[model samples]
Target: MATETPTSGSADGYYDFHDHDDAAHLHALGYQSEFKRDMSPWANFSLGFTYLSPVVGVYTVFAFALATGGPPMIWAFVLAGLGQLMVALIFSEVVAQFPVAGGVYPWARRLWGRKYAWMTGWVYIIALLVTISSVVYGAGPFIASVFGFTPSVDTTIACALGLLVLATIINFMGTSVLAKAAIIGFTAELVGALVVGAWLLIAHREQSITVLFDTFGTEGDSGSYLPAFAAAALIGVYQYYGFEACGDVAEEVKDPGRLIPKAMRQTIYIGGAAATFVCLALVLSVTDIGAVVSGEVTDPVSAVLEEAFGTVGARAVLVIVLLSFLSCAMSLQAAASRLLYSYGRDDMIMGSSLLKKFSPTRHIPPYALVVSAIVPAIIVIGSRVSENAITKIISFATLGMYLGFQMVILAALRARLKGWVPSGKYTLGAWGLPVNIIALVYGVIAMVNMAWPRTPDAAWYDNWIVALSGVIVVAVGLVYMAIHPLHDRSTAPYDDAIPKK
Candidate 1:
């Protein structure tokens, strides 16, 4: 057992200023520090919040949801929000027990073993990288809208690549700058959600509250609203994710055992409410619902905003949405780079040494950051070659992330069944078992709902891309694991002094 140090500042007086308590906790987990602990509690919250950016998530999928299911699709946001809250509870428990960086990878490793951990990390890192591309590509149209330019394929690709490069530069500046930028993003998103949502609901409301229940007569020949409504639920399912980014940066957060768990729950609470509210406001504010559903007005959000606030006011809101997109990409890139660095630290990836190398002066992982930036840029460029590239990439990101999340939850639940008690300060006690089960159930349902083929009229690949892409990612991981099996390289036994109970 490792002895607990006194709660007072260290004899050298440095503990009062530096995060010596967090350092001791890391030592107890058998890890040596390579990153600076500069993230405050709010900064940690901001990381998860910005990654779950309501503006970005809602704006990206708004038109699709509206067109597919009309105003009734807002219910999907409510349902998915409740389901995701269950998952967030499970995540908070696990992260509290093992507040290590790389999020699901280390948590799964601690609960299960090395092989499972490798695959979990593999899926998660790929999801995050592809998420960066998805977010950047989603932002392209809005960028064009703000600048009063038509968004051609070439212009969209150029804008995405430029945003990626800028975000990469900010990430290279180190955690302090990254945390500050995240706080700015959180503020902008929160303000936009409240101010814009309230303005739309108050000044330009066209639809009644009853409209939320109506499917706008788009149930088609089937006459049942369930299918279209469920299909539209994809927007909410994808929006609720990105909260796990908090755990990915656990090593840099102060007193993460307590702070990170709180951050996760708060991220869900604030992000879910904001997204639901914005969706409700936008749905009610539509000047012409028939036009939106019929595709006569392609961009309902901009159209509604321009009708209520004029083109100048709509462009002003777009500026904030653009910032949300940029911040979201930055947060995703930061999480992906940290995950790479964590895998490299364990010699689990291809370029372990180089990827794990931290800059001495800047205190950032340069190579990992560079790779994170470059790969997403390449994916954006690939959009020029394949017409369906962005759609497929977004599907991969959503499915892959949910898969990784469930793997960790399942491992934790299995460990619990075997008497692996949570010994962290933030344990759920009697509530842990039930919450874990509900979270697992929710994850499986969401995964199936997302992967099920919805587009019958489209080509075969377009309809089945999510399922197909997921299988490919898993097969590749399995093949790599078979070729270069990981040996059981356990860390020093965890010291009990870190956990409160």
Candidate 2:
């Protein structure tokens, strides 16, 4: 068991050696996981894409839409999907080439350099941590629904923390446990979507197909169907997130690069289709958007389910919600641990050595898992969950992760475009340049839109909390960088898969 490396750096430790890093540091945290080859591609896809975080995505897109509008929010989720697609495809290209722990940060380093890459990593890790908070907090309503009682914030907090502890225990058990969790998570999530989706399609009698393009040829601020589409798309974007969790455990997978990339992409597309259908069902089933809106002020899904199917439907969705929340909680803790471990190994985190240390018996970062929950236990304390706040925080992190996502894609795209990096069997081919350009532009836009203050879009005080969490996290990372100063003394060598100039 490794303890974190001391935060103290020496003043007299500057030395130059002209040897390039072997770059094992790039992969050692088990990043670009090699163990994936052991599983079938479907398992790979399921594991990579399915998990607890996607639930967070659903909450993000749907709730955000609901808050902004009403059932019309379905259209907004669709737009969100389009926004995410640009990044997904581009991210696909980058991961195909440089499947490293730093992911986007490494890509940025290659595109820009180490300094810029470090900045992005700082943001990415913090974003991930914030996401952990949101996932746990958001799981509450569902937990309450399953048991036939409303859980107070205190009860909800305990449940979430307990969920994290159990997840951590399973995580400490190793890849096999993760695979099992993925299978269960996949079944629960997909099947849940199927039930909900089928209900919307078959059970939903209204042929509101016009809602799809309701205002394309017509117009008015009376809820332009276009914005609704955009809203639905964006919400879809939220649901499709955490697809990268599969790749984070690259070391445990057999054919890490190929399977992880394929899985990551597959999860996005499948999750997208499933999410859209579910959104449609919920919107269609609602008899009175205004009444449902007012009634669901606290728990929208519960409100809509009750409104739609009465006692039976509400109860059923409650059970599903419990399943979904558990799935997300497990997957989230796993992903966050890897991120923390990644940053620690690089000493970007203060106690890198300790946090990155793997359990000799478990082959997992037990300490990392413990710390992961400990950090968020605060949220479990007295606080108005502000599920929207949680969503924004996740979105906030998603943007940070996007920076890492964008940087790497830019590097791979530049290499492929310039013929700098050797073309691989999986290269993006002729579509590389054009597709990459589109993705980069979309990424920049997404980041800017996310960062822009949207008081009209969110609760003023809650938004302030979300923004504050991200800012403080990033600022601390910068301060850590200034104090630590990179040193060659302890860093493990990098591998040849990554280039060192």
Candidate 3:
């Protein structure tokens, strides 16, 4: 491993590498290349694509988006895809400059300072863990459906626990296994989505493309469409995020500076297109759009699948969906463990030494993987209290991730304004600042839309739950930071300079 030393490079151009090795580039960013660089560009892209699983995202949120905003909600996929593509562009540049593990956390640390990174990591870690639980828990019913069992809370919890354990074991096998699993998951999801989507569009089309513009007046008492559309945007917002996971395992990917950017953007492009196609197919296949919009028909995705393909075919598809969920949970676990290892390696959190310890032979952080699994397992266990517990836990996840991404973006913008240009292989050139500004604006608006209190008639806390949960988490982090002061504890170099090419 190379010692932490700043490599000599021009401040205004692409960073120069000592050789073709990614380790030399990583060392320049102030860290040893600990993980084996075995992941190819395709594997890296697969990790992000699986993490941003179209099947899982579309199936999970389809009913809600349709019910809340009517058929027109399909446009949210397009809006979110374009907006998040901008964010992905910003991430590519940052990761190209400082392609360190922990993705947003390390990016923010280098671009701004430790405190900002600490907060960003804290929020993102929470979100990732919760999202793991959400994905597995969400997969429970599919598991039951595939196996021909009733999906009670107990069965669901049991299935979730089983999945959690399976994914954890896979993570313990190290990066190669994880990468291969992601690729398999990506293949299954893409193939399933394509076949199912084509089938639905061809033989099961119940509505025309013009129905996509029909709102069905789901705007409710507001007498306006924008609010409903904004609320419905969560479908796309949630689907587009897993792209950042590509950078989370920077040390494991070869030529991360250049390849990771391409991987990130590809995750968005390919993943977004897959999501939109699947969503459009499902939307067009719905037999009764008004019934769905008026809350009479729930679970439209499952309904359409079963109706179009019958029980046997739907179950086969459920098998694919379950695989997507498994891969998604595994990818999320990998990302969380890497971030924890990054923090631990930097001595930025409590139990730093333990979390930083990698499996000697496997070259993976065993302790950090365990920590990642344990937290989400506990969150899954919380389902005993109420099914809604999982809902509440996950409600803040998308918001937390967006918040973390914006922190990095905001940090980069701050550094840029202070005359720090991105010296990465993937710099946006003259368009960097304009792109950065627009990304930030779009992120803030999406966050507000997500955190906005849309459930007016429900209890106040329920209505304000998303915003309230985010505030509470941040406040808790603030209190913990004040007492422990983990911000200034990192020994890792926090400079923004990259090696000159």
lDDT of each: 0.82, 0.57, 0.85
- RMSD value for candidate 3: 3.7
- Tens-digit per-residue lDDT, 1-501, candidate 2: 111111211111111112112133224322333222234556656665565234445643565555445555555455655655555655554444445543455445444445656676667656666666667776765667766777776777777777666766676777667777767777878766777657656765344655543322222355454443443344544565666666666555544445566676677677777777777766565444444345445455666666656787767766665666666767767767766676666665567778778776666677778777777666555345455445554566566666556665566566555443322213354565666777777767665555555455656655455446557777887787788766223343232223345
User: Residue 262, candidate 2: how far off, in angstroms?
Assistant: 1.4
Clashes of 1: 0
Can you rank all candidates by TM-score, best first? 3, 1, 2
Model 3 lDDT per residue over 245-288, tens place: 99999889887877888899889989989999999999999999
- The Cα RMSD of model 1 versus the native structure comes to 4.7
Worst 10 residues of 2 by lDDT: 8-17
Models 1 onward score TM values of 0.93, 0.80, 0.95
Pairing residues by index, what is the TM-score of model 3? 0.95
Name the weakest run of 10 consecutive residues (lDDT summed) in model 1.
1-10
Task: Output the number of the lDDT-best candidate.
Answer: 3
> In model 1, which regions exceed 4 Å deviation?
1-20, 388-390, 486-501
